[model samples]
Target: MKKSLRTRLYACLWCLGMFVFLMPEHTNAQGAAPSEHLVFSFPADAVLKMHKVKIVQSAYTEYFEMNSFTSGYAGLQQTPDSSKGSSHTLISSLWDPNTSAGIYSSVAYQASNTYTGRFGGEGDGYQSINPYNWVMNTWYNQVIRAWKSNGQLYVATFMNNLSTNQWFHTVTLAMPAPSNFLGSGNDAFLENWDSNVKWNGAFVRKAFFKDCWNLNTSGVWQKHTSRYFSANAGDSARNGIYDRAFDAGYDSTEDAYYMVHGGSTTPGAGFGTGRTLTLPAQTNQGTAPVITAGVISSVTASYASGITTVNWTNDNTTSPQLSAKVEILDAGGTVLYTQQDTLPQKRSTTFMATLSAGSYTARVTVRDIFNNLSAAVTGSFTVSGRGTDTTFYKFKNAYSNLYLGVKDSSTANSATISQYAGSNSYNLQWYASTQSNGSIVLINRRSGKALDLPGSAQTAGTHPIQYTVTNGTNQQWNLVVATGSTFLIQSNMSNHYVLDDSASSTLQGTGIILYAASGTSGSANQQWYQESVSSGLSSLSGAAVSAALMPAPPVTASVLQVFPNPAVNVVNITCKKMNAKMWIWFYDVPGRVVKRVAVTGSPMQVDISSLLPGTYFVKYGNETVTFVKE
Candidate 1:
């Protein structure tokens, strides 16, 4: 009985021993080769570090680690799952400082569609994983930035896909108190993390690392000029397994350091473990990006939509801008609304705010990848209260003295607008209806179509047209107060441009277009005087002309006619039968007198050679006529 019990015990003990021996081979299987690393040396501690990686050869169950700092690591990995074809992912992880004391790294911000949680096995820590199907042989730029904020250390990771020219903010991790900012021990590695024995010696993993830069604590950038090649000795020591299929060295042809492991990769001479490789002297150590101050040219507030559109132009087109921030401030300089857009390539942006009628300013600033900020630029605009006048009126151009009318009085959509002699025609009349947001819509009496900017074209020569009323922004207008009773008919499309008679032509049937606004008091062609029409007139034929629409006699006190209004060098004023010498003042759009002369002749020739090419107003006695100097 004793011999039988001993035999059974020995048999059980042998099976248990076999199970223990096979566990390492089955569960703890290492890749076919040892993991290779390129340890970089930095001159000082860095607050920000950037690295580039190009996967030359990739396989399943391989991790091409990019930025590995002292506290965390970030990289791209290919999972062992072949069912989904190529399962790629981007991982950023930070080890906990002390798990027992409950001090650990936590997620500060996690991008959408990304996973962030606690991870274990190697060490307890926080990790973020984005399921990114990265393509092979493509270069990707990665960045890790650290800063101390709110008494805690924060680290953020970013990646740029060079193929698509798209940037992605992977994750931001915040470490609790007693945690250090980004320190030393920076390196990159090619790891085969899969323990599947079938993948051992079956797949190759290779990549190139270059353009490694670190922004040191002193706000200076330092480039990596040398690298030390090594492998993970811990894996071999713990698993009792070792494979020599690994190689890493500086590739002069690519100007980058190449690392490879697994699948028959033989270590080259002078690249043995713990060997340091010196790279060629680099002439182009990249400098920090500079973002020139953005220019905010126009800011228009739309009362109808409660939207304030800000337009700007960036001078830094070569540098990749990360974002543009816009702030709307009230008259007191208090910020009322703020908006940020990641697409800094766009020339314009809008902010929606329910603001009262008042003046406001729009401020814009741009930021680059290095967190460099551009100087702020600002523009001012006014939001007028809603118009209470419901009267239908004629829009007479201040420069041409011709009425705004539809071409040929056509009721078709997209019928171009033109200037014509005043008449009782419905096409020449528009009813301004105040919108909920204080903007006005000009509905023509003839076709019920709204005055439109036609697809909201930003070009200066784009003619205004009539379209069915959809109350779009192109159909909205803002009557900005100009000199005297005239108003600059500003388009809601850009708010920077106003209605203008083409070439400031006084001839009837000339087209009207949009041009950039001159200033608060715009050019004569861009300004208009609204004449209220009597409600009794219904038809055009045999209709009595309103006294206000009648043209002044050639010699009347209310008429100062100028020949060759858009003259090159001189203008002839025709005021026949003048007796007394009168002082004639030529004023620019802002009501500033540019030229003054005392003349008594019936026809006075005024030399306008010194005047710039723009609209000018000539006032003689009580009469004023606007002319354009070409």
Candidate 2:
């Protein structure tokens, strides 16, 4: 071959050599290697079907021209050189002291002495990312997966760039692996092909290898134990550690699986000392599937026409073989509908179900093939004919199953409130108003009062009180929707403060107070499951409160409530939890008691058509509330 042609051919051959690097026939030799190199070997009889390895490169160092190559690699192989009759594949990072292109990974395989295969190129040969882009002292994770496909063995390699937080697409090797080539064992090696020369001190600080897992024919990932041996240990001619290299094992603080033994470059030099070496172990055990509730990363309900679709994303990277189950529940916590299915390792799944114009909760749970179940995640939604319906709601604590209500249904300033077991009462019903500032105010449907923090106190342990709506910061709360369709009422006065059940007490009248919110635990105490109720409707005949419309509060209002204010014809007066004898006096702007009506059961009618069109106020006892008559 011509000089130029020969150089080209040698370059091609070297590239191909990366994948099919020299496989020595060591009869019993495990990870033993030359002093200037490191090799890690798995236990005897261990079959490696998949491997996840990470490495942090050493800082750059000047290499003499005499040094032909410095390389690192990982792959499946048959130990005991005689095992070459079996199958083997390797992905190698090779560097030539004379090359300008820096470093690259190439694929090489050998099923038999005569039928070897090699394809060489830049790191892009099988991966989109260039191995040359690897930064020194930065961790990089690489995984090699092997499986039998269509009666042939195949291997694909992938890498995760820790710095960029992105995973490079898998580079599938083009060569076909032998059909019967089940990897007998796995190995990782680092080498300096130079000889008869050494730098004064440790040239490469250290290389780490940890988090080793092997897939078996059973399709289960099993952890592997690694063993390392220095080449030509104590050999003077080979410059073994004390000669040229040396290594130590079981450095508990330094590594969990394996650690590299650093060495000085000088001939007959001592082993490198005081070098810190460690590779943090990625999760070892299989990870259960992660179930997210709602429409991708949120707990709020996602609404649609005629039906509510609940969506969730599953993350089972650690355990790809898994299944999932989703459940939809009504206010009574009964599982009205359920869907059970299996999905590919990581996926987004949705559950679409028709609900009878009511509020419902959706929960999803996932389990790995190993039978480990994930925590159940939930979100909520309402199925209504009108999507724009922003009806009033009463919150019931899931733990206690009690409705949140104002004390005595009072209209007084700063009236204390607590959780109560109630049904079909107006005091427990609350109107939720989303303010311009992104906060929410929970107003009592009966008193029209805002849930407040007294004097806007910033300290913890303050009991939440209710007062007529003033739109004060003390009265404004933030609805923090958490998993399980539960919401935490966080105070606007203090972002960290939240409405919590006093000591998580389940007894009725237990004070609902404020406490510092946490990322997890206290959230349950502050959480509420919402049940929406339609606000009163209007009619020309006379506005009447529908029995079905008011269904959460335990106490009916003790005062009068008028609908379709500015009434042109008849007006309806609703007296819930009210004394039938208490007289309600309606006054016009001139302060004259124009009408004195006797309080009665709900739906009491007052013919306001005879009155002038204007605003009026209704009074009872020393308290007064207003309404418009337009």
| Number of backbone-clashing residue pairs for each candidate, in the order shown | 1, 18
lDDT string for model 1 (1-630, tens) is 011212222222221111112132434445445666777777777877788899988776567879877667788877655332336878788777776655566665565566766665435667777777788889988878776643556677878787875667767776653444576556787765544565554577789888888888777877665557776554553222436667777677777778887766666877556434444533444564322333333434333344466767654322334467877787999876666644323446544334567888888777754667777878888877842234477878878888999999999999999999988899999877544343677889899899998777858889999999866788878776564346788887755688898887999999998888887578888878767687443222113324333324323443345644345687777553453534566765433345766665745788999976545678665567665565
User: In model 1, how large is the Cα lDDT of residue 284?
Assistant: 44
- Tens digits of per-residue lDDT for model 2 on 132-233? 344434444554444433222334344444566444322332222333333434444333322213331244434444444554455445554433434333
* Sequence-dependent TM-score of model 2: 0.31
Predict model 2's lDDT versus the native.
0.46
| Highest-scoring model, TM-score | 1
Model 1, runs deviating above 4 Å? 1-31, 81-86, 177-180, 237-242, 271-326, 330-356, 375-630
TM-score of each: 0.49, 0.31
What is the C-alpha local distance difference test score of each model?
0.66, 0.46
**In terms of TM-score, how similar is model 1 to the real structure?**
0.49
